[model samples]
Target chain A: MPYQAVPCRVLSLTGGKRDNDLILPINSSLSVTLHQDQLKTTTTAAASRDFTEDRLWLNGEEADMGHPRLQACLREVQRLAHKRRGGSAEDAGPLSLSYKIHVATENNFPTAAGLASSAAGYACLVSALARLYGRDSLALQVAPETHWPELRVLVMVVSGEKKPVGSTAGMQTSVDTSPLLKHRAEVVVPERLELMMRHIRERDFEGFGQLTMRDSNQFHATCLDTFPPIFYLNDTSRHIIALAHRFNAHHGRTKVAYTFDAGPNAVIFTLADTVAEFVEVVKRSFPPATNGDPFLRGLPVGSASLPEELLAAVVMEPVPGAIRYILHTQPGPGPQLLDDPSQHLLGADGLPRCSA
Target chain B: MPYQAVPCRVLSLTGGKRDNDLILPINSSLSVTLHQDQLKTTTTAAASRDFTEDRLWLNGEEADMGHPRLQACLREVQRLAHKRRGGSAEDAGPLSLSYKIHVATENNFPTAAGLASSAAGYACLVSALARLYGRDSLALQVAPETHWPELRVLVMVVSGEKKPVGSTAGMQTSVDTSPLLKHRAEVVVPERLELMMRHIRERDFEGFGQLTMRDSNQFHATCLDTFPPIFYLNDTSRHIIALAHRFNAHHGRTKVAYTFDAGPNAVIFTLADTVAEFVEVVKRSFPPATNGDPFLRGLPVGSASLPEELLAAVVMEPVPGAIRYILHTQPGPGPQLLDDPSQHLLGADGLPRCSA
Candidate 1:
C-alpha cells in the first residue's frame, strides 16, 4: 500500500473523516489541516532555464536534497510537469531535466513540536512550485480558509523537549515492528473510515468525536505495540483522554474528542456549542501552575457549568501547568491565494521576498 | 476456550511461566501460589451435627454463600471429599452435603493493596478444608516456600486508593468488550505460553523476562482495547516501563523486565546477579522525597553503578515517592507445615481459636 506522506499518519496511521463524509484516505491520513495563514511556512521557489542545479533551504538555512523523500517528491512533481508541457514550455523545449529550481522553506511554529509543521512546509513548497511552474491540475487543490467555520481545533501544547522523531521515520518503524498496527491498517481503518465519513455527512459531532477518539487510541495502542514502544501520550495527554471520556459519558454523549499528534499536544474536536464547555474542563483539569495562564489558546467559554457528576467522575488532581497553553483554531481552506504583495514570499524578480 | 483460571490467571489473563516450567495450567490459572508462612491467611472450619446450614464469615463478617464461584469451589471440594471413603464406616453415610460446616477466614494483608491477599486467603481455606475432610487424593498440594531460588519478585506498590475493580468483573468486561483480548486468548497466549515454558526450563533470565513483560503488555493492551477501557498503569507505571526498556537497551541486554498486575503496581523480574544494579537504577530514577525510606525491601545492593548510559537514556524527572514500598521476596516454596498447635486456626472444639 502506498504510505500516507501526510504528517498526521505519524501520530496515528488512520485519519478519520476530515472531509466530513465525502471520501476517506484508505491509508488513514486522518490529518486535521490547519489554516496556513498565521502558522504559515512560506516557500519561495524559482525555476529558470539559466539555473544549472537544484537546491533547497528550510527556515532560511540550505537543507540537503539528498534525502530520498525529497528526491522522490521532486522527481514525481517534475516528471508530471515535464509530461504536461514538453513541446511548448514558453519556447523552452522538452521540459525534462532542462530546468533547475531553487526552493526555500520556513516554519512559523517550532519544528518537531508535533504540530504537523512538516505538513505545512511540504504543502507550501508544493503550492509555491505549482505556482512557479504556472501549472494548475487536479494534483494540487486549494480552497479559501473560511470554508469550514464550525470545525474547531484546540492544541493542548505539551512539553516538546524530546528530539523530534520525523514522521515518516517513526511510521516506518511502526510498520516494521507493530502487529497491532498491521491489523488496524488492514482490518480496522476501512470500516471505521466509512463510518466516520457517514458521521461527518450527518454532521454528527458526537459520533465524529467518538470515532476520532477511538482511532487515536488505536493508533497509540499500535505505538505501544511497537517493540521498544513509543510514548506520544504523556500524563497530561492521558488526562485529556480520560477527561474527555468522563465528560462525554457524564453528558450521555461526546461533547469533546481529543487527538494527539506525534507530540504530547492534544488536538481536541468540538462543535461551537460544546467547545466552550470542553475548554472549561481542560482549564479545571490542567490548572495553570505557572504565572502565565494555562488555558493555552481557545475560545474561552466562560466558567462553564461543570456538573457535579462530571466533576466527581473525572477523579483526578490537577497537575497544574501540565499543559503549557492552548491554540484556538477552526477548520478552513487549504493553502490560500496571496492577494497582498507583502504576504508573498517571492518577489517579481523570482527571488525570496523575505531573507531566507 | 476455558479460562485457565488458576490463580495466575487471576492476576493477569496471560499467565507467565511462574512455576519454573513445571505443570503449566493451560486453562490460564496463571496464578502464582504465595507462601502461607510469610503472607498468612488463617481459616477455621467446623463440621458439627448440630449445624443446620453451611455458613461463611469473611474477616469476621458473614458473606453470602450464593455467589457461584464460591459455591462451585465449595461444591467441587465437598463432592470430592464425599466420594472418597464415603458410605463406608470411615465416612459419614452418603457424605454429600451431610456435614454442614461453619467456616471463618481472615487475611492479615490489606485486600485493596494490590497484593494478592485474596489468593493467599482462598488457598488457606482450601488447604484447611482438604485437611479437615481427610481428602488426601491429588486435591490439595503444598511444599516449602523457597522452591525456586533464582526467581525474585519486587512489588512497586501503586495507588490502591481507587475502589477495587473485582478481577472477575474486570475480566468479564474485557472478554465482552475487547476484540484484542479475544485474539490474545485464542491466538497469542498459546504460543507465548509454550515459549515461556521453554524459557523457564532453559533458566534463561533474558528470555523469561522478555516473555513476562510482553504477556503483561498484551494483557494491558487488551484492557486498553476494552470499551470505556480500564487503566491499571498510571504515569508511574508507564514511566517504569519506559525506564526498563531504556535501561535494557542501553546495557544492550535484558538485565531487567517489568510486568504490571491489574493495578498500577509493577512486578519487576530480574536475576540475582542484576537485581542490585536494577534496584539502583530504580532508586536514581525515582528518588524519594518524603522522610520515609525509598528502597522498600531488596538486597540493599548499596548504590550499584548507575551507568552513565542508563542514566542519560532514561530521560525522566524524579517523581519523588511515586511508589509506596517495594516488597522484597524470592520464589520460595508453597505453604509450609504448621507445627505448633497454637498455629492451627481451629481449636480442638472444632471452632475458631479467635473470638471472631
Candidate 2:
C-alpha cells in the first residue's frame, strides 16, 4: 500500500475546542510518532500544484475543500514554507528542501463530548508536516532559532478557521511572571500517579477517569492562587470539580484529575499503578449515566516512552469520541535528520509519492 | 458632684456570645437618656413582680461557670465595665433561656487594619449568645418584642454593657427571602446606614484608619452575600476592588462589596461581575494614595426607623474606641421566649441573681 499525496494529516487529537490563545510556546521539545493504520492508502494521483483547487483523492474519492478553516490551513502552511525558504528572487533561495504532502485524518472520537479536538488536530498537523518537509528538527527544538515567529506560524496553521482565540500567549506570559517558576519541580508519578497511568494505557477507563479528575482539580487550584489569580476553572468547572470531589469522598479514589484547555473540556489524567482500584471505585461511586459504561469499553491507553524499566503506562487515552485519540508520549529530543531516503514522502521534484 | 444611680438608667445593652453550640438570651427592657455630657439619666422604670435581685447592674461581678467560651467573653466585658454597677450579684437565678447557634465568619478587608474589630466583636458575642440561648432569629432582630418577655426586656436590661457590639440580627432577618435572591441586585444607599438610634448613637474619630479598612473589604462582602447578601456602598471599597482586577484579568466582579454593622466598622466583598468594566479597571483608574490617607474611604449609609427626617439622616461618626470588625452572617429569625425559666439567672425567690 502506498501513501497518498496530501498537504498535511490533521489529527484532531483533542475531542473539544481549545482556546487557541492560551497555547503559548514554551522552551521544550514536542514529538509524535504516527502509526501506519492511521493513514489513508490509495492509488489515485492528481495534479501537484494548487492542491486546494484540485479534487484530490482522500480516504477513497476526490475530496473537495469544503471547509474554509481547512483551506486557510493549507494556504497558511504553504505561505510559511515559502517564507522560510525566503520569498521570490529578492529573498533567500528555496527553503532547504520542500515537498508535496498527503494527509489522512480520523474522527477517532464522537462529536462534542467536551474533549479537546483542537489540541490533537494542531499537534498532529504539525507532526505530519514536519515529517513530510523534513523540518522535524526545527519543529522539536526547545528555544529554536526561530521561536516566536515559527510558533506563531504553526499556531496560525493549526488554528486555521478559528480567529486565534488567544492561543498560549497569555498563559505563557503568566508563567514568565510566576515567582514559583524558579522553584518549578516536575512531579514524576510516584507509585500513585504511575499506577493510574499504567491502568489508563491498559484501557482501564474507570481507573483512568478517577485519577485524571482528581489531579486536574489540584492543578487548577494551584493555578488559581498563583500570584495574580489565573482562573482556568470556572463555576461550571467548579461544579464538575465538586462532583468529582463528592464522588471521590464517597467512594474510594478513582480516575478524577481534569485538565482544561483554553476551553472547558476535561483531559483526564490517571495514575498507572492503581488502575483497577481506581476503575472499581469510579464504577461504584458515580452514576452509570454520567460516568458512561462500567466495562469502560473502547478506551485506548497510549504508552509514553521512558528510559527506565518503569511500569508500562498510558499517559493519555480516548474517552470514546469525546476525547481525540490520546497521544502516548514522553519527553523526547528535538526533531533530527533521517539518514535513510526511503522514509522520505517527497521526490526530487518536490511532489509526494507513495513509494520514495 | 456625686454620681447618683440615675433611677432606672440603662448603662448599656448586650446580647451575649453566639457560636455553633450556645445561645444567650437578652430579653429585658429599660429606658434612659444620655445627658449632654454622655452620662446616663433614667426617666421610667417598670415595677414588676420580678425581684430586685432579678435586675442586672452594670458593675455587678459574676462567677465563671467553667464554660470556657462564656467565661472568656464575660470576663472581657466585665473587666471593661469595671465597677460601674458596684458589687457582684449575690446568688443570681437560673438562666431562663438557652440558645443553640452556628456561626461562620471571615473578614472582607485587611485584618490588622482595625476595621474588623466592631463587626467581629459584635457578631462574635451576638452569634454566640444566639447559639447559647437557642434564639432563632437572624442577626438583626434579637430585641424589640411587644408582649410578655417583651421587647422592653431585651432593649432595657440587655442595654447595660459599657460597650456592647451592635447586632444586625434584627434587620437582616426582618427582610423577606425570595427567588429573586439569585439575581444580582444593586445596593442603593436610599439613606446612609450610619443613622443614630437614641439608644445606640455614633461617635467620630478624628481620622479614618481601621474602620475604613475593614468596611472596605470584610463588612461589605458580608452584606453582599448575607443570609441573602445585602449591598452597602463605600466609594473606597468599590475603587479598591476595581483596582485589584485592573492588574489581573482573572479577577471577578464578586470580589468587592461593602457592609456596615451598628458601629463604624465596614466590610467589603469581591467577585468578578459579567459587566464589561471590572474592579481592576476601576482600581487602576483611581488616583494614588496621598501621604497616610487611603486612596479611598468607605462611608456608611442605610435606612433608619425614626419618623423625624433630621434624625433619619443622622450619620454614625467613627468613634476612636470602635475598632474595625468583620464577620460572616446568614439569614436568621428573631429572639423567642424561653419556655423554661429554670434557665433564668434569678432564683425562685425572684430577687437575687443566680451564679450562672
**Which candidate number maximizes TM-score?**
1
How displaced is residue B188 in candidate 2, in Å?
Answer: 26
DockQ of every candidate structure: 0.37, 0.03
**Model 2 chain B worst lDDT window (10 residues):** B150-159
Cα lDDT of model 2 by residue, B242-283, tens digit: 233332333322233332333223233222121113212332
Score residue A305 of candidate 1 by CA lDDT.
81
Clashes of each: 22, 197
Total backbone clashes of candidate 1, pairs 3 or more residues apart or in separate chains = 22
Cα-based lDDT at residue A56, candidate 1 = 77
Error at A184, model 1, angstroms: 2.0
Error of 2 at A63 (Å): 13
Q: What does the lDDT read for residue A287 in candidate 1?
A: 80
